[model samples]
Target: MLEDLLLQGAQPNYADNIRAIAARWEALIPPARLGDLESGDLQAGIVSILESGEVTDDVILTIAGDLASLSWWRGPPLRDDHRARLNALTRARLTRLADSLEMAPRKLPRSQLRRSHVLLVGNLLDPLHSPSGGAIDYAAALASDTAVSRVEIVHSGEVLPAMRTYIEARLGGFPASRGVALVSTRDNPDFLADILSRGPCTFHVWCEPALSPAISLVSRLGPTLMFTCADEAPVQFADVYWYFQSEAHIEKVWKAHAAPQEFIDRYVRILALPSPEPRPLEPMSRASIGLPEDAFVIATVGNRLGVEMDEAYITGIELALRSQPKAVWMVVGGLPDYLLGAFEQVLGDRFLHVPFSRELDRLMTTVDLFANPFRAGGGNSANIAVGAGAAVLSLSRGDVSSLVPDSFIASDPEEYFRYLGFLMDSPELLAAVKAEQGQHNARMRDQGLFLKEIQGLVRLAADRYEARGCGAPLSTTVFAPLTRLAQAG
Candidate 1:
């Protein structure tokens, strides 16, 4: 019934949502039929259900689902007119029912969270969750904190085996040992109740159009935060922060998105990650990717998608290859044919593409200089290569700039070439650059530092919820976009 309207780009209207509620209720509860009460009659029928005082599972769902949808209006007016139309007394009665149903929360008893029963929500379980690197780091960072009672994940229902391997290797013991649950339910319909059961969630779902109904449900939880993993998001919330790639480089991005200044002022940065053991830099050669031992290899990796950065990345590589006789480029991740063709014209046997690797550290070990793609940028791959003591020549343009060091992240395209040219001109400079970045990488790996930030964010969330007063009827998509009016019963 709702499909035709939704296909034409309509936000769910009152009639549309009421139809769904009536349909579902009728389907679920046969004997207690919603007879002819489909659209305009739904409000009265719903009110009558409460009057009967014999609530069943289906009845409560019909109420809760309707209320959640009722909360979906986004506007300058903030509150919904449909909700406001009811008399104050009727509104109070509805609010009380919501409170009783646990659809609207109140203050969390101190015992309820206990540092937290954490729920880390994200879209994918592959690659430790963030290709730009926060998900992997934050998971480890949250685990490293002794104060955080548990570490669980709500992914898009697919738990790759490598994710378990990464957790076990990085955190010692996981899933079983710590009772670290992986609630694989990012977009699942049945996941709402399970998520509501877990307090203090950190969702990787950001200010984007793809915000799932389940995610919107979690937003109503007192302690929830939206973490951005991409450059653009169509929607935002009151309690939103980002996956910090750099400590001091997010201003441009926040501005680009027209994020509220108040939100930006109180914004949290990316938490640090424990430095994974670097691939040994000693006697480095091209043997890992089966290249000649004598080659001066420059590598770039990750899902280097989108065509915007193709020109810059190819040009940087070609310049280096042309200048240095033995210089070759090894790339991983699926590159577009145009990028490959661009390389072939200027760099024949000098350019090679490696298949995607689960153990990306192995690929980093082969890179003498890592050239990060321009527009799409890098975070996870950049972290690994730099941590592995590989010298990196990264983009100054995009989100990748925030993920890399300012000292190394070049603002000028010329900087990428200059650094690559310097290394090509004097091979001796390579060791010193690696030595410097390795020291920086070691400081970044501090477990205590990462844990402190994670614990602080966790504690701050609980504290903020407390200060704001718990279970303060949250708006689903934005703050006060639609309020469920409460009238005295």
Candidate 2:
């Protein structure tokens, strides 16, 4: 069955067969990088898989995870037909899942609700040690509401050392009577189900589509909120869709899935998760970093440079440097050798590659302009740059990139380059932009404001769940907004 599905132009109706083929191919050639999907053959295979099957919960989820990893801005684009088919499949699968989860309406009085005990489920790289954005978001959620009596974190994978320290600190910080624990479920569905059965708690799934099967099941237990965190589609099980990006951008994402206007209006809400406060650091000079003291420095900082920094991004830097004599490019993160070689071949000493540093805050002080490549992630770095008083330049697409002020955000490649040139040429204008961004950054980082908003959204989600009479299903055919004709089959 797998072989027949893998054969060129062969279409399969069973989703389980597509899942088998995908699993086999993944084992045969494990993707080393996100850009692996950029290969023409791989893209064709993915499109074929999407077109072949009746989207099952597992297959659609796996495909969504793969699509999320692609550098959509710099791509061998998926055809319109394939995109439409994928969307149709996604809507159909979600509708069926919603129907299956529906239960008889039974109202549980508000007094019986265990709203004080909050449960957060997701994949954290290292909540205790490494301060990844997801980790910070999780921590912030725990600290956001002092009114809550208990916080339970059910995460996948092994609990790292840092997580232990965080748990200790959280326990110490809260009243001795309160409870706090971070348990690793090891991605076991039964274990997760057991945890969910413990109490009537508000659940938040801060995960990518890959983990949807395990985490999405939370909706069956209680009021479930899924933080999109810039992941592609909304999880079908989530009652409320929480996002960090602008409302307009969130609407745009839902619209692409062909969501009905009513579905979006009722479920979508924007809330900025709190980021760690930037600590004070002594400023570093250009010469200290081995750059010309008087040179105009333009830098892009990120952890996944290999994935985000493509050939076009490099070419753009090269063009900007060649055109502006005093302009120098400094990249502060890891990159593949091929990309590094491209940088060296074009601009010799003018390009400075700094390994990921602890003194990133100090280094930001020296930069004149922080240029963000057109990519999916990097909201934290961009916010840091803005707070550090660097004029941030980005294309107005991506969840992270769209956070910049309108004047600095470019609509297209031409505008991006134009904005960069204008900023480089006029120091006065650059300084003004930086000041504007700093103000915006300050507002975004307001811990109190974020906490207030998050608390309200949680209440809102709980209210909606209660209003729906507890276990009664939320949406049925609402997800099949634009695919009703196809869904009729």
Model 2 CA lDDT for position 33: 24
The alpha-carbon RMSD values of the candidates against the true structure, listed in the order shown, are: 11.9, 6.5
Query: Candidate 1, after superposition: displacement of residue 282 in Å?
Result: 8.9
Clashing pairs in 2: 128-162, 128-163, 129-162
Question: Residue 385 in candidate 2 has what lDDT?
Answer: 73
Q: What is the overall TM-score of model 1 with all chains considered together?
A: 0.67
lDDT of 1 by residue, 260-311 (tens): 3534554577545544544464543566567888888887776533233445
lDDT of 1 at 270: 53
Q: List model 2 lDDT by residue over 79-110, tens digit each.
A: 44455456555555554454465456545444
Residue 432 lDDT in model 1? 74
Candidate 1 clashing pairs, residues 3+ apart or interchain: 91-486, 91-487, 92-486, 92-487, 92-488, 105-471, 207-235, 244-270, 275-445
